[model samples]
Target: MAKNNEFLWRRLHSLLGIIPVGLFLTQHLIVNHFATKGVDAFNEAAHFMESLPFRYALEIFVIFLPLMFHAFYGIYIAFTAKNNTQRFSTFRNWMFVAQRITGIFLVIFIAWHVYETRWQVAIGADKADFNMMADILGNPWMFGFYVAGVLAATFHLANGIWSFLVSWGITQSAASQRVATYVTLGIFVALSVVGIRALLAFVV
Candidate 1:
């Protein structure tokens, strides 16, 4: 019974990471990518999202709750899960270790990000605009930190998609898994470019 419950929880965690969480991450990067266009472009995109109907309700139910569950459960898994890299160093094995590492890092990165941006906006301490981002990334250290954070986020999502496919039985054969690996790598590169470009836009 305990194993069964764990299996269910793991399944739900994988599903949530892909559905709303992955989708949201992609959308957020795209929105930020508008920064590359210009200040007004980014602000317009950001404001449009902020003005969505039932925004707060959607945020709490769709984004925050699922994210909290995934983040906390992922931390538990990260600390408890064993890796086979020591005995059998393989591509997937390394990826498994990397996934846990990135997951842990993301927890910290996301928390700081939300506090720096969302919490400030909520408390009227800052505006969620291009200017605000520009100021934050104005510091060289912060710029470097954000670059690392963006890379970590993209890698996590891309690799998570590969795992999601195999665990969900979407790609069971070795050949299919190989294909997924390439596809997910492409996703990582593409997202990293988008994210970093947005960050650079702020400092520029």
Candidate 2:
């Protein structure tokens, strides 16, 4: 029973970590979404986040802590998985591959995003300065990279949400499950378009 308890306990953490990350990503996207309205719009929102002391405290607890736990658990899962990719051949099986690919994308993109934005803020520069964003967007390479990141991150969030629900026993019926997965997929594509459109508005 102890082993069973441990399994359930770990699953609890995984569920909490998973859903929280998705919700937070939406919030993050909304903040970045302000970029669509131009730098001042993004700057106004970004300044509020960085300038406020209370918000910093919230970031430490809400963003950093959970992010650490979730990333670690994700790495653990990826490394310990005994199932080979070729072990299955269905569309469902392809999801595992897709998940890993996007997971890697998010990790890399988030690191670069922090280096560009948060790192500047750390050194007393306004990371959200509209001018900085404009400068970055002026680079075709950087712009392309961000476009890809936004797409991959959206897919990772939406698809992962459905997977989390199934793993947590939340969406149970086969018909309901199928519908939920489809809806999550649709949401992913919709968000990707929103994100790309936002980027284009900034660039053009």
Candidate 3:
């Protein structure tokens, strides 16, 4: 029973990553890309998001809850699982380690990002807009941090998708897994480009 529960939770964790969390990340990148069109366009996008009916409720269920579960359960998995990459240098093994490492980095980055943007706006201390992002990213140090964070996040999501396929038994054969890996690599590259472009829109 305990083992079954563990399996179920792990499955749920993987499902959450590809569903609401992953979908949210894609939407976030698209919205942030509007910054390239200037402040007006960016703010208009923000206003549209805010104007959605029951936006806060949607945020709680679709964004916050899933994100929190995925992160915490991920941390639990990371801590409980053994890392044998050093002993066995295989591609899949290294990717397993990389997933954990990136997950840790993302937790820190996401917390800081949410506090600086969402929490501040909620408390009336800041507004979510292009100017706010520009101010944050204008600093060289902050810009570098964002670049690193975005890359880590992109890799994590892409790799998570690959893992999700295997976990759900969608890619069972070695050939299929390899194809999924290549596809995920392509996704990582594409998302990285979009993410970096969004970041540059603020500073450049």
Tell me how many clashing residue pairs each candidate has. Answer: 0, 0, 0
Of candidate 2, the 10-residue stretch with the lowest lDDT total is 1-10
Q: Against the unseen true structure, what C-alpha lDDT does each candidate score?
A: 0.93, 0.76, 0.93
- What tens-digit string does per-residue lDDT give for candidate 1 at 45-132? 9999999999999899888988999999999999998787999899888999999999999999899999999999999999999999
For model 3 the local lDDT of residue 93 reads 95
Task: Assess every candidate by TM-score.
Answer: 0.96, 0.86, 0.96
Model 3 lDDT, residue 8, Cα: 84
Candidate 3 TM-score, true structure as reference: 0.96
Off by over 4 Å in 1: 1-4
The residue-level lDDT of candidate 3 at 70 comes to: 99
Give lDDT tens digits, candidate 2, residues 1-204.
434575764685567555577677777777777888876788798778677778777777777777766666666666665656676777666777677677767777888888788887778775567677778888999999999899888887777877877887889998878998899999898788777876776677
Candidate 1, residue 137: the lDDT equals 98
Candidate 2 error regions (>4 Å): 1-9, 82-87
| Model 3 pairs in collision | none
Ranking by TM-score: 3, 1, 2
